[model samples]
Target: MPGRVFLTTPVAEIAARFGLDPEPVANEPPRQNISPGQTVVALTPEGLQHMRWGMIPVGRVNARGRPVMETIVNARSETVFDKSAFAGTGRAVLPVDGWYEWTGERRRKIAWRIRSAEPGLLFFAAITDTWTAPGGQVVPQIATVTCEPNADVRPVHHRMAVIIKAEDVPIWLNGSEERAAQLMNPWPDGRLVVEAATGVDWSDT
Candidate 1:
């Protein structure tokens, strides 16, 4: 699944692409290594905004009725709709220039950058939720959805983020669950270009 995301594009541009008002542009700097727990740029039914990249499953439970203790960065497309653990979650779209995947052994892992072959952005289908902390601090969070990888990404990873098309972004954000599920398929073969991530530092900044 997508562990890291890169969005070097300006937030204003992203807002414009989704037909959102770019006024009072948010100060989202060029980020090449957005990890879990960090805020990510996303398009919700309301509008474009930033949402935390992981969902803390506080009161949620699994199929077996056990409490889910881990933070969820990506949810499997197959069970996302049916899982009780995901009940009451809203939907959103996380736009990005690309994402990073890793391969190889534990000590000698290789990093690969995957992006759309075309000259534009890619949108990942996502789920959203709100968590109220101890002091009533409300935090909005999100988790990308994942499916089997396409031909281009299969060689490097077994699964890839569920990338919805630019035209289908509205459906992913506002459509019914059944309708959204229809858009969870992988990107078309050869539509993605994966290359070895070089030079750029992977340090947790």
Candidate 2:
């Protein structure tokens, strides 16, 4: 699962990079433990926007007729479109400065940070959808897509976000299912560098 990402870029930079119009932009909040149901930055046809991290399907109702709050924060790229919840909405970008993962003795997990090798920001593959409340209120949501681990990520975690190259961003964002799936492989081994830490804590920095 892709969890615990950090976005350090200012909103203006993100807007400029994606050619998005001005909108509400905020830096990372104080949530050291951001789990499902939280909101995160995700791109959509509407432009670079913020949406709930979990993906709640439209028209899905519980026995109480209330919309279910989806707890899914990550979706596998290989089967996203094949799944009913994300059939037509299986392509998007989740920009981040880096991500945090745990690694160490099984008994005691230590945290580490993995960032993009390039100078700018990193965009991870994502799927987005909209949900309507019983009162006719609409809410948008997104889930990051993951694939097998690449070299730099294998030692840290078994899965990594599906990162699309700039040249293929358009194709991944708005291309055929078959074509987009083809780009969801682990990043090349040396594309990223990892630095071990005493523990997984970014609060000091």
User: For this target, which candidate reaches the highest lDDT against the unseen true structure?
Assistant: 1
Global lDDT of each candidate: 0.90, 0.73
**TM-score of candidate 2 on Cα atoms, chains taken together:** 0.81
Model 2, stretches more than 4 Å misplaced? 24-35, 57-70, 105-107, 197-205
Q: Where does model 1 exceed 4 Å of error?
A: 23-25
Task: For each candidate, give its TM-score against the true structure.
Answer: 0.96, 0.81
List of clashing residue pairs for candidate 1: none
Residues 65-167 of candidate 2: C-alpha lDDT, one tens digit per residue: 6764566688887777675545556567877777778887887877777877767677888887777878998888788899998889988898898888866
Best prediction by TM-score? 1
Clashes per candidate, residues 3 or more apart or on different chains: 0, 0
Q: Candidate 2: minimum summed lDDT over ten consecutive residues — where? A: 26-35
Candidate 1 lDDT by residue in tens digits, 57-172: 99999999999999999999999999999999999999899999999999899999999898899999999999988999998899999999999999999999999988998888
